[model samples]
Target: HLERLRALAREVGLEAPLYTCTAWGGAAVPAEGFLPMHAAYPFTPWEPDPSFEPVPSREFLFRSPQQPAADWWQAGAFRYPIERYPYAYCELGAGIQMTYLHRPLVPPECTQALAVVALGSGCNWLGYYMYHGGSNPPGRRGFLNEFTVPRLSYDFQAPLGEYGQLHASYHRLRLIHLFLAEFGDRLAPLPVVLPPGASTLKPQVTNVLRYAARAHQDQGFLFLSVYQDHAETADLEGIALEVLLPQERLRLPHEGSLRLLRGMSAILPVGLELGDGLRLRYATAQPLTVLHARERRCVVFFAPDGLQPEFALARQGCRALTVQGGSSAEEGETLYAWPLPGLGTRLEATGLSGRGVELLVLSQEQALRCWKVRLAGTEYLLLTESEGAAWVDAGEERLTVCWQGEAQLDLLSYPRLPSSLPATGLLEDRGTAGVFWRYRLQCPPWKARWSLEQPEPQVVRLRLAAEALEGVRDLFLRVDCVADVGQAFLDGHLVADYFGSDLPWIIGLKRFAQPGRELELILRFTPLQANAPVLRYFTRERLPLPASDGTLPVTVRAVQLVPEYGIELPWQE
Candidate 1:
């Protein structure tokens, strides 16, 4: 894959660089065929001391081409001191660290001091494994050791803690981002050449390109905080508002709101200040970037890089029209238009009346699209091949023409005495559409319904040897049934009656027969109903079924039977 990619890049005049391999902490790497030398630290059952000093435990060290060192390397990927083995280690065995930027914690004092000394020392680009930490996605609740997952607040102790509304790290990272944006290309190609005087900040030169966006070079940084807030845009001074990265700051224009990100994109919020017009721009690309905002004063700018006049807004009574000359226009007072070929236009409006209004797109004749007001008083319109669409007022109650052409009806039955029936039958060949036995049943007296489909022919017989005739409330046999396309019978008596239909059932007592002394069932099936269903049969031992109060525990045993297939051809015995 790498060779093919390199060849493709060379053919297309592209630069291809390979990243280095980093070790994951495990005794046995599952997919790869390898054995273990030892286990890692912390998880190696070592006791934590009161002093909080570094104590050596069992942990894997690197097998390098060079000599070894003393302690673990916290900053650089390579060049760290190895205690027991020969090479430098990259990742630790999962210890908690924190960085808070972008936005601060509600209470900033908690993570006021500790900055990311590790990644900051050697790496050009740095990120707190979690700066403004938050909860993991919800999993199974109320299980033992549920808190094995971290708490909701991921606030690791860092320079800017998790709780402040705005953290100090926010400004720090933003400044770094701005600086890096100005000089990222030089930084990426240039090796990290550490200068003297910064002993605490270790600088080891390596070809490590850390964070990346898809552009030949990505020159911006994104920082996330703990609070659930909308994208906010700030006036970045000293840079041309147009040239200084089209995608920038955004804030929740409304109170208690935030935007949900479907995927990665260059669309950020332009925070709307009260009484101020907010203009935001985004470069149009494939998988069109969508901005969902609540306030109307906020407008989105679709400014493709190297393209002109890229801005749009959803306005009332206005239509986004794409003309034949590859131009786009918003139909307002002056008809502000832009040139577009394949791109169609959309106009969205909210807070309209229920009677609905019509907007005319006049070419040679009136080609208007009429829209009906929704339940929330908003109107929706979809462009079609037809130059005209009509909208009729959907009265107080919303009128919806559901295209459910026919009613799928199934008639069920209710039975008094409950009995289990089998489902299955023998046919000429082992093909489907043959008659299989299933018991459809309903209990009108118990207000309960049930059925057995494709059931086998079996009886749950209870023989009273005359001496074992004890505790008999009422001796009556009940077969629950359903009439799918024909009449269902219990003991040769019709329990469920149906005509020219296909449905499932739970009918135990038919008009033709009721459960009395003997229990025998003959089910009449039609071609319209499903194949005979499987049966579940059990004797109603303590009969009269709830005796008088009509509420008794009925026990039924399950019997499952599957068909056995025939032998295959061309076999050598």
Candidate 2:
């Protein structure tokens, strides 16, 4: 069968540079001249017992000869040496989908911690199975998903929601992605070095610190994982770590011990080269990304929630350097900072070899709004927390940015300015209090109306009727309710499902609706258990009843019909 598939690819005009075969289910012989791949998940089915340890399965890490082979492969070709091929993980489960028997809720911090552990464990390539949640389509035989799978919705509670809503995990994972995009090429060939007690630590051990590093060419990244799966961890106090670099052995903090809080993971730099003149000695803060400005290059790093921003710098042949907005002291050849504040921490170092470097330290919340976008072949870094539209400079012309709400420009940052501006002048030197450019713009209104009626004790029937939807491109039925589980049906067909949590419920209605047809939507809701131990453990609040009939209330908030908009730029040739 593998040979036939390879032959079919040749029969067609398909020529792939790399060939890969799935080696996840059981140990199988790799196809000739093909890359072998495996899948990994950090969490399993949630057990009711509080002592349950969530860790990756043994099949994900090791290959065994005594193990049973999968039914698809022959028995003799099942087991082989794993070190012959490059180690890579293609389908690392980012988040788990809830089945009928098991419904496990994964916190956003756990997902980020797992990704850091995978990269630190010498994984050459890291990939996710479902980065975005999606809705399952109808099948000809039956429903597309498996029997235990949810009937309508396939939302895995991923970083991006089913309706393209951004979650907090999206911004947290973006920080990791941006770092990889800048430094991954240099880190690909490095070898993993585990700490002293990392191999002996079990999933239940919370006292022992887990750490790993990658070393190559006198530089390394110390990866620390302070989180354990399905287990509550205590805060580590007065922690001091030692990292062995190529040229020297560096100790972190440089003065006193630092603390590692629960559910926190960071990648600290060791002997990192910042351009030609400056070199980082040691830092507890995690590097986010690098920004290339007109005159200087900005390196942004984030300090964790309760941790202080302490770092050291060593200058080699730089003429003049200054530290502003943060407490600093120098000892011999190294510069140190005790506790850098959340905002306005900059390191301006000048006069040696190339462009000057500015180290910008920000809090985790402030770093979430920083987005890197490319417009007109130029990259722009925007720092705004607004959920509306904004006007930004794209070289000589201005471009408008809009998402899902009212159009407004809250902040603008660019290397150059446009010729014309709005009536509101661009404010400057406001010292981080009010430096945003505000604007108000108009957008199309919602064109559809919907209402819900409870016909049965466990059923909710929603009727949606809309007119002038010809110009509307994307239509959505958004439900804002507080329920346990919801199953949505359109015109007697099971279309989507949703799990009610803190997030909003949304379903795409364009595929099931016509221009003039009345859409009949049915929703079945499930009530939460009053005595469930797991619910109280996570939510901390007791479940309340909406009514005495044990029926969950469902509400249809908005039926939005979104239209397409384009920005016309002035042509320059």
Candidate 3:
């Protein structure tokens, strides 16, 4: 079978390396005859430590690699080629799919910090298990999900919801992705460098800051993080730190100390080569993405609040240098500093043979919304604000935005976006800063209205007239209820399921809506059990589902159906 597949790939002129993902417990699964690029997906179910501080525990997990540093199993179980393959992960868990017994609610900060830590810990290629989640297919006997999970909702708590709704984790991971897309070429070769006590540090250590560096030829990035979800952590004020790289040691800021606030994270560049004459000594901010104009590259950086961002530059054959929207301090190496709220601030350097790169600074709030999208034949860094993007289909000229309650669309694009560019929705001109054009997206109102019906004791139904939804693009059905287990069915066919952890369900009704037919949805919700033992689960499964226990409650508070808007930016227009 492998030979046939290889031959077919060769016939099609595909030359990509072939690899297989397997588990450690499986036998003959790694397949000795296959190539040595075999790897396994690693998952860490984070739990609150009763003995140690949460900050240090979170830091340790991020600093450690997915694979074992030295594994005897690699020598016995399979012939793994460690040197040939870069330290990578089959799945590095951007977010976890929740189970009924163990429901761990993950926050955006967890993933954002995890991504930076993963990259700094020597993971070159980061692959998430379920980047986009969906419904599990129906099996021969029952639903395809395991006994521990829900029958229908595989998205449980993934980064992207089952109906393509983008969550907070999605945007956080997108920030890391945008950075990797911009600096991955240079970051791929640098080896991770840790501090002297990094390996020996325990989970109780909160006095020190968590940091790591990756350097090559004295040029790389320093990864810093201060966020953790498991435990409550306070802000660190006036924290003195030193980055002990393999070659040399240097004190941070090169001026005063820094205050590492709670939930703060960044990636600072070190001696990074820009063009031929420009070299970045260091920066206190995080690198987001780069935008290219006709002649120059606008290198972007995100300066978190509370700390002033400074950039140190190395001069090579330069007679003069200048900066705009920022101030320069003449020192051993010329350092340029930008104040707080440095939103869309532009800086230019004319020295070093005129080969200097431009810098675009963004505040931490704006940086979260910073995303890369191909618009009108060019890629631009678009700030989505609190309003986010679900998917951008450049080929179909569609941009889908998902909102739960009230949909507020705010977008900012670099290089001045025109008003007439969007195919759908109104782009209100909110003005511009520097070369950026700010626009607020406005779409048509909802057309469809719904009525509720209580058919059975624990079951309810929603009816939407097909006539009202005739021209509607998409309708998102948000169910706000106090039920434990929720299930949504269309035409008596089960399509969605949810446990108690899903506070309000965001189900996309457009997919199941038939053409010229009235939309009918059947829903069933059960009361949450206070203490359902796992040992008695099998015996309880055979019995009928209890509607309520009087002590526990179940109520369908409200059901809302909102129309989703999609706008398209042309690729060739």
Candidate 4:
């Protein structure tokens, strides 16, 4: 298959590395295998059919709180030539769709912790499966899907929803992505070194600290995961975690111990050069990203929840210091200890080379809102109050920012500001938030509502306000139902089908939209056996179906129509 793909790629002008996928072992037998780390690597993902486990592919990283996997095998990172193929994961389960038998809604925090655990376990490159969700395209016969998945909707419960709406996981996962964008090139080559207890630390052990390091000789990142899916663990309190380096081990937080609240993860810096001359001994806060102004470069960091943001700067390399928005104290006479507030804190120091090195700290929430965008020639961080996906087309002289839910835009640039950013529509310059130019967009909670009508029994018909499709690039239908199964028909043809297990299934409506033709979505309910053994299996997984009179109710609880629009503006200089 890959050979034919390579041939096709050559015939066309497409450039993509080709590799066959395989799984060590999974629910989706042939499909469920270890996705090769990359197209370059020999490994490929083998996804099994009907896998509903939150962290299904890598069973070793998590142990169920209710039932610990004391004997779960750890063959996720298969034994392969290390030098030739780096132990990397391009498809980690940041989020997996709940199957029919298992309806576990994976918490965003668990996905974040999973990424950290993968990194701690020596994964250099990190990628996620179903970071975005979509519905399966209909085949010549019916919908494109396996037996276990839904007929039409493959929501996957991912960061990006079926209609490109951002989920909470999108913001939570970007925290690590921004860090990797800045430091991954340096972290990639560092060999993973697991400390004795940290390596063997099982998922069920709450008392023991789980940690590992990616280091060369001394400089490295201390990675830790405090959360596990399908498990309840005690909070790791007042623990001064130890990071094992190749040369020697060192205790983090030069002064006090920190607590690891369940559902949090971190990658702390160790012996890293902040700039040209300044050397960081260690830091309690996670590095977010570096912002560059033509005149100065400011390294941004986010303080992890439940821990004070602190940095240990080595005195040997430091020459002069100037603090802004916070204070720094001398820890003994060796290193400068700077305890920082989450936001509005800056440390401008002249290192041994007398070059300016700037460090900026933002609250975790603020960091989550930040999106790095390249406008004109300067790099700017588009800090949004809510998730607002942005697109900048310099050639077209347009800037389009789209929002599904609530939205607030704050523009900040480094090195150079745009020649002019005219605030139009709902955008107005509310003034500067330190370096951020805040704007409040007046958008309603909902653009349109879907009116439900049952023209006949066991049948549902929907009507939307005309305004729903007025300026929408695309419109998606959010449907809630109480039934076992349902089939959607368009002009008497079976277009889509749904299993009523997952509430609020989003179906894209644009595909069925035909110009100058009326679009009618008629749904017929044909539920599964109310007493089906499969449903009993689903009950055992903890998502109980309240069976009524031995018949699944074909009731549509709520129907909503959400329109996604890209607010177009003249391209900012």
Candidate number of the best lDDT: 3
Query: Candidate 2 lDDT (Cα, whole model)?
Result: 0.62
Residue 259 of model 3, lDDT score: 84
Candidate 2 residue-wise lDDT, 447-520, digit = tens:
54666677874577777675534434345556655556778877676778866554456776666777688788
Q: Give stretches of model 4 more than 4 Å off.
A: 1-79, 243-250, 320-326, 333-343, 352-355, 387-397, 406-419, 423-426, 442-450, 455-459, 465-467, 516-518, 524-548, 552-555
In angstroms, the error of model 2 at 413 is 3.1
The worst-scoring run of ten residues by lDDT in candidate 4 lies at 38-47
Candidate 3 lDDT by residue in tens digits, 1-573:
665666697799986665454432322433343433223222233333212222324333334332333332333443354455565555556667655554555666766776777777777877666678888888888767866678878774567888877777887787778888889998988877776667654445555677878877678898877765555567888865575546666666776888888776668888776664776777887788887666676788888666667777764444445666667766654655553445547766555556667778788777776766665555677766543243433454544443333345667778766444643344667787555787776655655567888877578888988765553456778777655578888878888887755346778887787768888889888875535532122223333344455323556667777666655544343
lDDT (Cα atoms) of all candidates against the true structure: 0.24, 0.62, 0.64, 0.63
TM-score of decoy 1: 0.21
Clashing pairs counted in every model: 76, 1, 0, 25
Location of the lowest summed lDDT over 10 successive residues in candidate 3 = 47-56
Instruction: Please say which candidate is ahead in TM-score: 2 or 4.
Output: 4
lDDT, candidate 1, 1-60, per-residue tens: 434545686788886452222333322222222111221222211222212223322121
Kindly provide the TM-score of model 4 when superposed on the true structure, using C-alpha atoms: 0.80
Error of 3 at 486 (Å): 1.0
Give the C-alpha miss distance for residue 406 in model 4, angstroms. Answer: 5.3
For every candidate, C-alpha RMSD to the true structure in Å: 26.6, 5.9, 5.8, 6.0
Candidate 1 Cα deviation (angstroms), residue 437 = 86
